[model samples]
Target: MPVIALLLLDGVPGPHVTTPGVCFGTAARCHPRVAYEVRLCAAPGFRSAGGPGAFGVTTPWGLDGLDTLAEGDTVVVAGHSGHPDGPPPGVVAALRSATARGCRIGAVGAGTFTLAATGLLDGRRASTAPGLAAELARRHPAVDVAPDGAVVVDGPFHTATGVLGGVDLFLRLITLDHGDAVAVETERQMFLELYEPGPDQGVRADAPLPGDALGPTLGWLEARLDRPLTLDDLAGHAGLTVRGLSRRFRAETGLPPLQYLLRARIQRAQRLLERGDEPVARIAARTGLGTPANLRHHFQRYTGTTPSVYRAAFRSLVTSLTPPREVPPPGPGGPPAR
Candidate 1:
């Protein structure tokens, strides 16, 4: 099995260690065939921070363990309280060596600063906690810091901000290793909504939307998803000309107005399919896809599965994980008691 080594440094935050553990553990339980070996590799004399109480953390592996990782394995640097001061001694070299051996490197929250200190993230796009974004950029001007991104994957370097952002990153990693089905199953088992990576490939969908200029217009568009909206309608709502709206919209969202609208419709359809028993025709109409056939074409094109199959697969996964409730043994009535 491929290994996932979480490098725990001094003053490591508790969640950084537990998030990956839970995420990968859940994925393993859901699909053992693609399970990865999760290792908590700590630095010498590592301790927990920002928890109920600080405590010593002993691990089977240390910083040197990073050298053992190879192509299929991954090493994630856990965020630490000393992140602003840069990585401790031997960390930068150990991480660099791991990168040389083709081990994929990742970081969570302030851990991005640790990875950045090694010069590996220089000239690469990354994200840290929103509050530390400016400091990270100031310290490492070569690194492109996208403060608004929940998670940013540039090449083999993956970085995420905050606790939930770490979960998103690991889920994405699971998706890449296994498949969408396994990832979705893991998400459901964890009682988390299915997460879809943004169209930009690296960022999550919750990243900042269009600027204030089109904020209200975007809300207006969302309120009218069931309507057959035209480009002119969007422009009029934004109080801008069609050409201007197209330019600003593309600049902010990286897609044309209609293209973005189609994606939004498809996403809404997905939510409806997952959360309700609505038929494909009804969902299609509600999402403004016009008909079940059109919905299937676009949904399959975008999500790689037909609407019915998608719904059945998700529902079946949920059913498999849910415990069966016991029924009362015919409470002295002709019909079974509810």
Candidate 2:
């Protein structure tokens, strides 16, 4: 069991603050073998949601209470804070101290703004919502920023694009710490339905090709995701000369075989990233993208955002939609496909 200290900001959106607590709360409460302990730590006497007057809420510990941060623990920073331009000095100190002690750090949406304040993201990769990317880049020119993905896990730091997908990013982190089976079981138990990974992994075919030689050829192309299949290679698989296969494939698909293959490759890479926590290197290999550099190169050209950013945004979006599976029944259980 891992204890997750979820750091709340002054302006964190109501949904971002409450949903993870409810979802993970349910998951941890029901599961016998694994338990995820979550602590809601806010600035001293600072109440973000359901104010003292409305819900009579109060934080157990302010910044001073942040002493719980230590090794083998995680610090999750939430967004929608009143002052996202930066975190309070004391809060910043806590995050820096946590990092010094080897505590894993994560931020959601605008929360990345605070992490960047510490100079830890310099030359390191991170993600934020598109609305704030330019400002993030403008303020900290040294930190790499990706604003489209639901979330981005760079080194020990995890970032989300917006408040929408914070829970998904958190679940992915749990999956990274535990395992897929645990993560999936929790999800199933929670009955979460709002989560949609990314990119389409299904093979596309207008069934009954009417004796189209290129029909099986498409499946063959998909099968060789791990191997580089050039036009010649595809032609070989189709049992035709290079010119013949190229013409046929293009005529049938309305695109050149190479172009279609590249699109398919990028889409598959996307699915692997959003649903599975495979490293960019492994995904690159499995998708025949070869290297991380190559994956980023193709991903940027196709999606206008790097794969890293795309993953972050995807996670953030998922989290925002799907509350913790731990929430009492009928909380949030959406379909699990995009």
lDDT of 1 by residue, 244-266 (tens): 99998777666788887887787
Q: After superposing candidate 2 on the true structure, give the runs of residues whose Cα lies further than 4 Å from its correct spot.
A: 50-56, 163-165, 191-338
Give the top-scoring candidate (TM-score): 1
Displacement of the residue 227 alpha carbon in candidate 2, Å: 34
The TM-score of candidate 2 is 0.54
lDDT (tens digit, per residue) of candidate 2 on 1-338: 56677777765666666667765765554333346777778864355553322233356655654576677778877775454456665877888888888888988777788888889899998888768898888988999888564678888898876544376677777678656645554554354332222333112222213355577888777888788788888888788998998788666665677777876788688778789889999999998989999999987776667777778877876787664653434435754443
Q: How accurate is candidate 1 locally (lDDT)?
A: 0.78
Q: Which ten residues in a row have the lowest lDDT in candidate 2?
A: 200-209
